[model samples]
Target: MNIPTRSAIFLSLLFHRTVLSLQPPAPRAIVVGAGPVGIAASLVLASRHGYDVTLLESSPETSIQTKYDPTKAFLYNVNARGQTLTKMFPNLHDKLVKRSVESKGFADATITVVPADPNLPIPKSSKLEKSFEMRNNENNEAGNAMPKSEKAVGVGYWIPRHEMVGLMVECIDEHNEKGEGGKISFYTGKECTSVSPRDVGGVFVEVYQADLVVGADGMNSKVRECLSHPRSAVGGWSLDCPKPNYFKLKKWRSPASFLRIKVLQLPPQFEIPDAEGNPPLITNSENIYAIRSIYKGPRNYLSLGLLPMKNNTAVRATNIVTRPDHEVWKLKDGNAIQTWFEKAFPRMNFNGMISNEEWDRFARAEGTRFPHCQYSRGMAVWDENGDSGVALVGDAIHAFPPDIGQGVNAGLMDVVCLDRALSGLDTVTGKEAKSAKENDKPSLGKNLARYQKQHSPEIASLIRLARFGAPYQYRQPHRADRILRTLWTLNVAMRLILNKITFNLVPPTCIILSQRPELTFRQVMRKADLTTLFLKVVVFGLIGLRFRPRLEILSMLKP
Candidate 1:
């Protein structure tokens, strides 16, 4: 007789167990905040890792309560890194696409660089490439032309935060209905007071005690603080240990429509071809450049962000400061927001055309009420060396500026890395010998440290790149560097450099190979020789091109 299939055996075992026993034990996890990072983390742990997760949100409702919320104003571009993580969770990407616009081209449509001086006799540069673009406008056609191919820079999807949240919640609900081994319970209108570790080496979080705690609380994290290190306790790891700074002081506003303005110079390296099909020559050495402000139009708007660098005083002037009782400025109500924009920006001949009503609709649709800013600028990971089973992921650990739209993506990467580490340890400990022993393998401590050590350098590098990535026309020195930096910033050039540097410097694959040296001779040869040869070729090409104009000429020669 043939043995039963794995699924059939599993189903038979499940049916034979008592109805109550069929349900998995509640593997408690308390998530502090219900924001994107928190929700995403909770879902991953609960759905993928078979952990019982509960998400806590301070708000009474799952949806955005405020009308003129600044958080809702902008759309998130889910890049390749983020999509890779979402793919781990079934149907997440499809759900997100249903609610948002996906694009693979740049929003600006054309790349143009301006000169440092308005009177300087410099030609403007415009180069068209396949760039990603997305808008929060509901009326927007799904796929619009932007003078380039969709596959030029890889796939990118644009979805509003609210819509993204809804999709995640739906996934959680669907998984729960199937009575899967794990579940994600949502708690609204609850605040976490503290987290403390039990004697048995599990985390205990205090909310309203009667409530379930699957600690996914956010940055002012009570769960992280209480469980890792209680305030009153003296010996164990303390949560009060300084949290990592992940953001800087920056504020952004939404414009009712795309504004067209003339500036002296273009933000660095953003060169555009002139009407004569020639690269616009750069003259001014300073970094100050200009661009025609392209505002989001009609009932939709583009966001205006303010990020202040250390010692950058000019950022203060551009901060969105509104009076307490301005006639047009009501902080939370969307209907009243347009009036504020009209009064504050007042459409003049120099300013682009945008109406108050249009601004209000866009603000309401995008959920733009509160001001958006980051207090820290990078990711933080804390590991308690002893018995305390504690770890952090997502924004709590690696927060970056939204300029590159990698916030969600980075967080997803953290989840994948952490999950893999946990799985690896389980396999080694013989915990995977049977199904019952799998979930019983408690606490990921050393594995977490390893994960942090492995991921931090790359995360830090991304933070640095984002910090210096975009060329700012407002700064004099940056404007000058833009031209020299342009090629490096482009998607094609950046990928080449990133591959070379990450592969050579980090050698993640090499590290993995060294750990698992049981490969075939041919396989080892490919990894050791072929990979190195490929990298050498790329490095040589990059270095050789610096002294020669052949590649540039070839590119220009292409139709």
Candidate 2:
């Protein structure tokens, strides 16, 4: 029989206490919404950031959407920002790259852009095609645009949105398999009914507890409602966001209703034509075509998009219908409406423009749906206070029409920036531990404030840019839109002239997403504005040079 000595027992207990002290506490993180951004944030926090992650989904599956046409699929555009995020998660990126459709070859040529009035003296559709290309710097501007070591200002990828969600879930599963980060617990179909602060933990969701709560839910997010709603004495916790910061935010919605009609691939005969009238655009290849239809008046407009499936002949057809100051229209009776489709796009392939029959079929297959997007100013990627253990990402904060195809791209960027912010926080709490004493509670809230300040200006600029870019895609009855559209026309004309004169003009400062990965959204906007202003000034100088006598007389007559 062996009995431990009192000294041995005392030494053992002391050693155990020391070991526990040395080990850092695994941060408890709960992510609401298992959508694309939610899943990505979950994996990164668990695997890369080493947080104990819990992912919750309201739906039974990541996406409950069921496709009516076996050939058709949902799609998304992953831009430079999204690509930057992909680089952070190698496994996620690798899987997506393998199965995804690459869009390097896509250009303005893929789509036809015509003036609303055919006789409006605009260039040929070929010349007016808009391509999503990253901008190169005129000088230090280009240098400033590239973030990190990523040098190329490359075009984004166009993969199905559902595929993105599915693949993200798979990547997260794989990360969980390795058990690298604090063990991740994922639950789907279990809705997050309520969220409040716990006495013991920082945040509480239903029965689970966590140090932080990240809400990546989409536009209609319940989690966002909780964050937005004022806390009550009985039910919710107060989020002490400063009053001054509240005034900085501008919230507004486009009252206009939009109708989105999606159809499976065009029949064999209805192929998207190229400039030369070659075989259909999606005949046997995997190229996508995005075209904006020209309407005769300011009342209505449409955007047509065709994306190919990776391994199948089926192409996804999307039609976005916009009429100024109108309510969302629906087709429920399965009545055929081929007349308008034929009139607008007589040259295209198989079926008529979204036939009522097809629309009804889709409605039956999926549920009744309407795509609505609203804009709010000064919404950074993260919520106000990180110390509150609450943060929001993706459509929860800012959701807008895909004017520049940045809906998901912006969301993905949110995760990337948040990841960086958290990484810095980890350093401060560990390697920068001594420095934490200088700033009390230096971990989440302080780093989140840094994120808020650093990222707010850029996201605000993006929101404004999206609003400005809206007229080109959607018809606007507002007088302001009319004026902006006129200015936009002038900008486009000046751009053409400058490119003609300089032999190499900088990319138009349209305030769209940058091609270079490094530049902030605000940086891109500033460069675009500068380019626009330069072009305008140059054009004015040219006018004076050509009409010197008239200008001199006019200047002398001015009172």
Candidate 3:
């Protein structure tokens, strides 16, 4: 029976190979965003899947035309997970690194613990700070003649979002010049107002019809809104809908996960010193300094984190993130905010670092909040005939605070996953295509569903992990809060050590461990939950032991 079955399978495969490959017509895709995720999605669809793409951006053409916009620019730490997309496109990783601050010589970090008294001198530098300084100085002296091994040790790249988008656009233009797989037509200031999931679903940027509509637009996505508040049916047709529609998506809203952020732009080559007020040994771009205070007062001191931009000319963008109701947010004017900065971070030379104009700018800047983390149940919804569909990618489907820095990386991975899910159609022969057509089974709808299934769980795990796992500590003014955070961190470290010593008997949680590129977020979450249970059991056992002695003593007294 096995021999006959194998023979039959071989004969079927041989017959299929003998048939001529019939390429299907390229499907038209309308991607409704020109941000990093949307642009990358366009590249994948056009180059890999041979889909003619129309890229629509709501921002006017002038905004992205410049090399960089300091006021609006923020740095993205593109780690290995986000860099995985480079494998699909040639030389993209190199291009990104060339324009970014590479991790090897430029990614050193220094932390200074400030004294309680504003008049008191800054504390001495720790061993970690000394080592960072040494390495940075060595790199500077060596200049561009660094070793290949050292260069290969780069953990990631720190690139501004606008610059990354510019690089992607360059890739698109190059692909166009060489006549790559499919052509992409880019249009700026074309906002997507509505969508109709009727026959050959259309995106109403300008009433353009397409086989598929991709919602790569940002958090305030119009496509997501369209899905949530679909046109109501009336008299056998949707009056609200500019046209008739068959598919009505179940209304869904993202779970609210909010964090307010204020961005401060500091000048390039600014002199920032150590806790002892000593000038840094290396250029500012090579290191990130965090100035924290020791005082536990009514109002928490500002915990300023300054992340660098590109190597030479880029200015530093400092983020002052806090709860929406934090005391810092209550400061009404620039003078009040400047006073807070001067009081909160005393060791730093604020006079030399930030000018009066800069303070005013920071005050005038209106901070933004992180969007809720959610994915639509109908991420890949289609019409009744299954011939046309709408798919969502990037922030349109899932978003959260950029606390973990996986926001952009996860969005890029979505495009790669979508491409993998739909790649199965390339093997369909003419006979199979005709059979699929006759049977009313277009593979596009099925493939999109497959993508949703494969991608949704990761999205869920990512959101949960980002929202709850190893949150960044801002070192509040309360000593109790600091003590508890320290204990929690030590406990995590202890579990990791135990797992190593006990030969995996005690599984370690994925707190900071979630950043490992080899492990998926789902895998990370599973390990985290299991480790949590193990710790709980150990804690209960210890409690039982401690009480057992007391109980025995009490029994003796009773006797």
Candidate 4:
């Protein structure tokens, strides 16, 4: 028999008979952590696939019951990639947007490339103008072709992390209310101590026992450690992976990821009219301004961040300081439980720009910190026999610097890929009774390995993109070399290039499209366009970087 024919026959025979007798009668899953990724995973497994899921959370019950704060927002830009996944899951996008601030297009902002010099006043204009002009031209073309109504194609939503969490919680509740085939039970304030895999079968996890476990947990994941070390007596695995020394030779990889912010002093209502005659609108109580100034002095313009640093931690928190004057006071209680703003601004003088009342009100409204402010990229995955049933999505897999605004978008794409993979299996198995029987055999190891292999490369690329983008977008003059300093005004161009490269490189599975069956092909083309645009921008940006002169303007600007 021919090889193809023989393979087909083998497949048919395998489908007819169960490949492994170790299959469980009913598949039950436990997801650790109640963060966005964990919640998303639970919803997909339970709501879509009808799998029984139990989510374990370490927080206390009271905390879960409280309303979300807008101040502690996770600024998200749901790119086409992530949106595609959201489309797959019903009502997720709408709910997320409703509670979050949406950005229709890139915000008008500037980045100063020169190192901050305290002795010198911050420059009024840098290379930002040229960057803006270039971006404007691109926007004009894209805008003309896009419909007026749809022109608001979401770059993404600036949403509070807690808000997203609340929405996920609501969705889970709704699913349970609908009398769905599967159910989700959330255990709050309960922590998982350890997990041990059974020699005969499934893993046995010991949590608070008061609560159950479902999906993988966050940073402090007990299940993950257990799975990584099946032979360990104590449940927790050694941080090191159990593999050949050759595997140890594998290089550590960093992906492109960052959090970018456009900061401007709240211009006075009267002075809001700029040279362009465009008046800054008051969306809320605080006045908005469109000023682009570069920080040049002893202090650095931007700081690199990973996890939220504690008060004593050396890693400085970006955007705002740790302590501010304003505090939140509830009407019923004379005592104030929550403080509005934490840190004071030491460098930029607000002196006359802000009124005491305005500051107070601003403090009352925003509570000190900015909302929708963090971003990251990359997801975590592990390899086992070229397949990885265990994989991470969203913040769990890859957390990036918030500069590029791709954190949530990247995570959402992860969902899309994962869902698609799972759905494909479901579709194939459902079509034939023999196939369904065969599918009943679960290879946890194989699936986890596949998840890791498929996701790692993409995650690595994103991390690199983010790292490159963060310095440019934030214009951390301290980190810039001599060449970048000379052309400080051209920093925006650098950002545009970085944006293009990262976006273009993003995989197609990440972009969201209208679910209309007929439009599927068009969606694919749109993804291609996004990718092409990114590549072109990246190539041009690099060229621009190389050709831009370092001496001409520096001589003129020297005081």
Please report the candidate that would top TM-score against the real structure.
3
**Best candidate according to lDDT:** 3
Point out the higher-scoring one by TM-score: 1 or 3. Answer: 3
Winner of 1 and 3 under lDDT:
3
If ranked by TM-score, best first, what sequence of candidates would result? Answer: 3, 2, 4, 1
| TM-score versus the correct structure, for each prediction | 0.52, 0.70, 0.76, 0.54
Candidate 3 backbone collisions, by pair = none
Could you give me the TM-score of model 2 versus the true structure? Answer: 0.70
Residue-wise C-alpha lDDT for candidate 1, range 1-559, written one tens digit per residue: 9989999998988887867687656555666788766777777677766777767788887766222234333446676657766777768878766655455444222333332223333333333332112210222422221223212245666665565776787777888898775687887887777655444445555533211233344444554445433134443433433332222222222111111211111122223223334444432211222232233232222222222111111111112221222222234454455444433322212112334444444344322122232222222223253333445566654433343455676666566666665554332122332333455444444444444445555455444433433322111112223343333234323333444676644222221222221332123234544445665887899889785688788889999
Residues 1-559, model 2: lDDT tens digits: 9999999999999999999999988888999888778887887788776889999888786445222333235567676678777878887788778767665423332433322232333222331123321211211111112122112256556677667777887777787788787777888787776767654447777888887788787777666565554544442333444322342325544332243334433443244544443333434335444454443344443445556446454435554444423222343334333434444554443254345556456434432222344533323222233444666678876766665567778888877777766766432112232334565665676655555555556667666566554334443434565565555655555554554576645554454335555666677677667777786787899987999999799999999
Tens digit per residue, CA lDDT, model 3, 1-559: 4556888999988888766345466788889998888988899889987889999898889356335664556777777777877657876777887887665332243344334345554444443435334433633422112111111223778788887888888888888988978899998888888876553343334577787788999777888677666444531112221221222222222212455677877767665454345544333665555555442353554566665566655677777766565667777677787787776666556777777887877787768876655455445655544456677888887777665678888888777777766664321120122233455554676666666656667777877776565443443334454455455555666667767787877656464556577777888788778777887898999999989999899999994
lDDT of 4 by residue, 1-559 (tens): 6456888989988876774555543355567677777777788878776667767777787255334332443334455546666665677878866655444443322333211222333223323344344433633422112111112244545554665677778888888898775788777876766654333334445632211133345433455444443344442222232322211112222221122231112322222212223332222211111222232232422221111111121211123221122122221221121121111122233444444544443334433321222211212223222222233456544554555556666666666556544554321122212233554544444334334445455555555444433333333333233245324323333433444566735523211222122233234345545655765887899887876665557767899
Higher-ranked by TM-score: 2 or 3: 3
Instruction: Enumerate clash totals for all models, in the order shown.
Output: 64, 11, 0, 63
Model 2 per-residue lDDT at 462: 66
Order of candidate numbers by lDDT, starting with the best: 3, 2, 1, 4
